[model samples]
Target: MAQAARRLGVQMACWKAWECDRAAPQSNRLAMMAGILAVSPSWLLSGIGAGPLELEANDRAALLQELQIASAEAVASQKRVQQIVALLGSVPVAGDSP
Candidate 1:
C-alpha cells in the first residue's frame, strides 16, 4: 500500500485514509491510483469495470520470484547510488585552495 501510494504521488496517510473510508482521493488522484493499481478507474471507483485478476499458484510463485529479483536489483542500485554520492562529496570544485 505504501508503494502504491508513493507511485500515486500521495502521502501514506492519504492512502490509509482512502483505504479506511475516512476520506477520498480527488478525481486526478483517483485516476492515477487506478493506473497505479492496474484497475480501471470505474472499477476502482465503483467496482464495475476491469479489476485485478486472481493469480493461480504457479503465477503466484512466478510473481514472488520476480519480486525477489527486483528487490535485489533495487538494493544493489541503492548501494551504487550511495557510493556515487559519497565519491561526489569527496570531490572539490575548481579554484579551491589546494
Candidate 2:
C-alpha cells in the first residue's frame, strides 16, 4: 500500500498523518481504498459509509465532456503525425530503393 501511494506521488508522511487522525485506522478501510483510488480521503473517511464515491450529475457531465475533447485531440494528433510520416516517406533518400 505504501508503495502504491508512493507511485501515485503521495508522501509517506501524509499517509501516516492521516492514519494518526483516524479513530479506527484498521476499520476505516474506505480511507485506504480512497487513497488507492486516487480520490479525496476526507470524502471516504467522513462519508455515511464505505460505499463507492458519488459524483454530482453536473460534475460527471463535465468530466465526460473533458474526456471527449481529449479523445478528439488525440485522434487529430495521430492523423497529423501520420500525414507527416507519409510526407517524409515520399522524400527520396541517398542510396534508397526506388
Candidate 3:
C-alpha cells in the first residue's frame, strides 16, 4: 500500500497523518482503498448510496491534454539520454589507439 502510494506520488501522510481539516481515519482508509482501485470514494464506501462524482467534459479533455504533454516530455528525455550515451561511446580513449 505504501509502495503504491509512493508510485502515485501521494505521501503516506495523506493516508496516515491526522488532519483536523480532513475526514476521519476511517474515511481516509476508505478513500485510500478507492484510490488504489481507481474508483469513486463515495461509491466504494456506501455501495451506490450517492451517485459517483462525474467528471465534466472539459475537465476530462484537460486531463487528456496534460497526459499527452507528460508523455511527450518523457519521450524527449529518453531520446536525450540515448543521444548522450551514443556521444560518450564515440569518444576515443587515449590509451587504446585505433
Clash pairs, candidate 2, are: none
> How much does candidate 3 score in TM-score?
0.45
Candidate 2 lDDT over 1-98, as tens digits, reads 59855754556775566568743334355455576765666755665434455789999999999999999999999999999999998999899988
Task: Return the top candidate by TM-score.
Answer: 1
lDDT (tens digit, per residue) of candidate 1 on 3-98:
998898888999999999999999999988988888999998789989988899999999999999999999999999999999988999698866
Q: Estimate the TM-score of every prediction.
A: 0.57, 0.46, 0.45
lDDT by residue (tens digit), candidate 3, 1-98: 58755754567676444333354446656676666656777766556655445789999999999999999999999999999999989998799889
- State the weakest 10-residue window (summed lDDT) of model 3: 15-24
Candidate with more favorable, higher lDDT: 1 or 2: 1
Q: Judging by lDDT, tell me the better candidate of 1 and 3.
A: 1
Q: What does the lDDT come to for candidate 1?
A: 0.92
Query: Residue 29, candidate 2: how far off, in angstroms?
Result: 14
Poorest stretch of ten by lDDT in candidate 1: 89-98
Each model's C-alpha lDDT? 0.92, 0.71, 0.70
